[model samples]
Target: MAAASIMPPHTNPPPPATARDPTATVSDPQRHRDAPTPSLRALFLRAVDPSRPSSWSTAVADLLSSGDPVAALAAFAAALRANPAALRPALPPALRAAAAATSLSAGRQLHLLALRSGLFPSDAYSASALLHMYYHCSRPLDARRAFDEIPAPNPVIVTAMASGCVRNNLVYTALSIFRSMVASDSAGVVDEAAALVALSASARVPDRGITGGIHALVSKIGLDGHTGLANTMLDAYAKGGGHDLGAARKLFDMMERDVVSWNTMIALYAQNGLSTEALGLYSKMLIVGGGVRCNAVTLSAVLLACAHAGAIQAGKRIHNQVVRMGLEDNVYVGTSVVDMYSKCGKVEMAWKAFQKIKGKNILSWSAMIAGYGMHGYGQEALHVFTDMRKSGLKPNYITFISVLAACSHAGLLNEGRYWYNTMKTEFGIEPGVEHYGCMVDLLGHAGCLDEAYDLIKEMKAKPDAALWGALLSACRIYKNVELAKISAERLFELDATNSGYYVLLSNIYAEAGRWKDVERTRVLVKTRGIEKPPGYSSVELKGKIHLFYVGDKSHPQYKEIYAYLEKLLERIQEAGYVPNTGSVLHDLDVEERESMLRIHSEKLAVAFALMNSVQGSVIHVIKNLRVCTDCHAAIKIITKLTGREIIVRDIKRFHHFKDGLCSCGDYW
Candidate 1:
């Protein structure tokens, strides 16, 4: 292709050159004779005379204020063609900065102009600036070509190229270039050292080998512990995952920590699930020293700490501070609020906070969807997901995870399958193990156990413990002992140390009346030293969660709780209720078994919630396990007898019992 065709010509000419004389001047014979040779800058200064007839040199300077950089570059190119001497000073920098600020089309036009004029390789400064423009415009290959053609790349040029890679998330390429530069003969120089040092410091790339190499080089140059480099080093170590808090703390102790250092340490602790240490460090920062003012990042970090601790009181206080600080609408701060409320089991508050976000990005949608899914509001979760799509926010992997989970809980089997297919068909997202697990759970919980098992067999990647466990839970609900055994075997084969699968298998055998098989399973469980998971129930009262386990009688009002249960039983029996004695796993006499079924944790929590609340109040109960068969029966009776709606979120599904029936059709 002809080089001229690359840069389209300008349709409009520039203003008269004399108008730009203030910014640049032209060299005359007398001036060149006096100076012998004029510098590129002096040539522009000498050219700036309004009395001098307009030349191409002054026209190039006028392009800076053109508002449209593409047109400016074209006019400047036309001017350069008219007077080759105009590129002496202002033209190169002006063209470069303008290209950097404009679109790729404009940047390419500048490159075309340089190529057509044969000035691209002749001037190193202009060439470097052109390279920087290409880097800014996200043409990394073009940047590499520009750097390679520069003959001798300077530190600034090399750093710009490496940084472009970092910005584009090609940290692998950044490390490669840094490695090549450090192995060079003059690695100890400030220019080369700064490039590698900054790369190591930024934490964009998390390879200890590469960072350690850079650290050694820094020490070779006697440049260790410089605050900027140290901060970068600390971030690299913290984010790299191999480095421990001990090393990070040591680095922090040795260096003079500004806000960046403190923030790095606090964030590192939070990222690693070390919330206690992170809060401790934050307290130390406040009480031990007083100079540091917490910025938005610092406050968000502490807010995350509150979320993890489930410290609603502290989180609310921090939220108040966040509002007072006027960051309630900030996306990061808002995300923290959504996460805190969701983890605190107040998803409505999370949603309320999410709706107030002035700018909703992917994180905002993901947080809200996840919150709704956590609260078992599957319909609300699906609604928010649809709203996200209507608002033009493409669902990412995490968003899909939340949506799939909602479908699983709500038994939207066909919708779940459609979205699962859409991940790869429309969005080009290959299903990960977690996504596959969600699909299995969705289908398994929907009474499509055969299809769910087939899905596990059909997965591109091997199914993991989570997928098998989901199938096992479904088997337990549907009383499918055969598939339960298959799922149990698969789970044990993959992860033998897990005791939960053993319990699930044993429960399935018990539910099926296979006593011989149950005893065999018990022997296997004994051999593995597996313990069954304890049952727990949570009731929200006066903004506090009151949890009770099986056989729990430690409550201050246990006597009243039991008494309420007795009266409630009397009323339910009067309303034609019968005890579901079959829930007792052991083979015992019906009367003896019926007596034991009344003391389940969920029943205790239900009785307590009824005693504590007034009539007509909706009782919300969250259980750690699937609602027992006997408890499920009793809850249906209690709902009709007491005229109350009870929402029970069990491990496998949601049970909405109203007027002697469950919303799940007693299928789960």
Candidate 2:
């Protein structure tokens, strides 16, 4: 009764915790067991002295550190409730560390205790800790509110808020906060640099200016020398597009090098399409290793480099290393494996790796979908997407993009429209330029040229080269020179440097027998010096890729290759194949024209691939340009006479020829 009388009332109690010494850890059980029941004021006064508040807090932390988070969390909550103002700071951090180490239940207990203690509103420090508490517990909204409620927020609170928004995909919100902080020149605050650094890591592509401003602020405030803040700046620069790697390199060079510094540079190079540079940096990282472990992120970066370079051997070695290092099942690593294999044209290997993943994340799903789509396995891609949905995984914009591309390739017009609408109606994903391009390509490939043109014209967003290019391509196939000219003019207006558009228009004029227009187009090409990309054809034999061009005689077996091609031509012609040489736009005599068509890259590659394989084996050819009419006719005859499937993936679409018919049904 006397002790109760000595305690202060709830109305004017002591300040809530978190302002006390970070080192005042409550670390035992005996004191709590034997102590008198002190008043809140007494507890506050005693805690404010900076001595260890209670041994119980430390004991709980020890329990948490030892992986007995249940007990540690329970003990921490009990101690915190005893005198919240005196115990919250010590308990929340310990509880959060405990939660990260072992149990979310421990985190939950600490959070609930904070809420129940009625100290969260009164103490800014406590609120900040609570914000971090919720963040660590994966309750980002709660963390956001806690951060917002901080009376006069610091950089720590601002950083936490930005991180929370980004984790939830509120990229714009994070960007605004970062902009505000920069505008106010909050660089004087020590944590402001850290906040700017953190926000930069999640900033969108357009926010590169903001990110650079933050970096400038960091430099102006003289905090660029801080290693942690510098590393954060490095990550931000990499994530924020349009960053100058020169700046990143300069900062990295001036800083005392750490593993993180090296890793960030390597990742930046890999992410920004400089795969060769990434590999070079990785070599440097290897020579300069200083206890910097090769983390999953680093490994994933190098793996992507392998994908871009098509370095299958290097990727395989990395895969083995990943397994040996016991990181094979890491989701990020698994996703990278799928991507590498897919890009290397090992679709089956990608599928096998995908199946082995215990829990497939959205990235993994997107990678697989992309693999199937790229391999021209449209039906398989659709099936994978269906499976993804059945597994309760929501498809992101990338996923839809892949699926829509598959539909475009397979000419699944209805399915394409369904998904195009679904992304907007069901998923609330606004269609971007890429998405609109896919839709236009879908309708265009389906021979709905009018509808495709209308879609482009009615697009809420402005059309890009891809959209106009699709319509122009459709015109070429449909022999609609009027539409072709209109689309070509629009395309040139939008992108004056696209030589392909001019070349396509010239070809269309040739097809329409407009000699003057063809000459005019050639003159324009000459004046602009727009060099058309040389057409290339590739054939795979015994897993080796053999390449050829229209007049390529580089093969070691050039004589034999020509002899074999001539014999094949005689046989196919004998089988009633008349060379359709009209697609040859070059002015030449009839015999010379026929000769050129015979030696066209696709014909050369196909003839070689056919001769190298078994009699009935299917031949798969990839061509850099659209298959010419003569080549398509020759392939149809070859497939019919030899009874072999000849799958040709040209620039426009896949041509799957079996028996005398193609998937495009002679339309394209």
For candidate 1, give the lDDT: 0.69
RMSD of each: 10.3, 10.6
**How does candidate 1 fare on TM-score?**
0.64
- The local distance difference test score of each candidate is 0.69, 0.69
Give the CA lDDT, 0 to 100, for residue 259 in model 1.
Answer: 81
Give the runs in model 2 whose Cα sits over 4 Å from its true position.
Answer: 1-243, 246-256, 287-291, 421-430, 515-668
Tens digits of per-residue lDDT for model 2 on 313-345? 567777777788777778889899889877655
TM-score per candidate, chains pooled = 0.64, 0.60
Cα lDDT of candidate 2 equals 0.69
Kindly list the per-residue Cα lDDT of model 1 for residues 295-324, writing each as its tens digit: 788777877876664546556777887888
Write down the worst ten-residue block by lDDT for model 2: 1-10
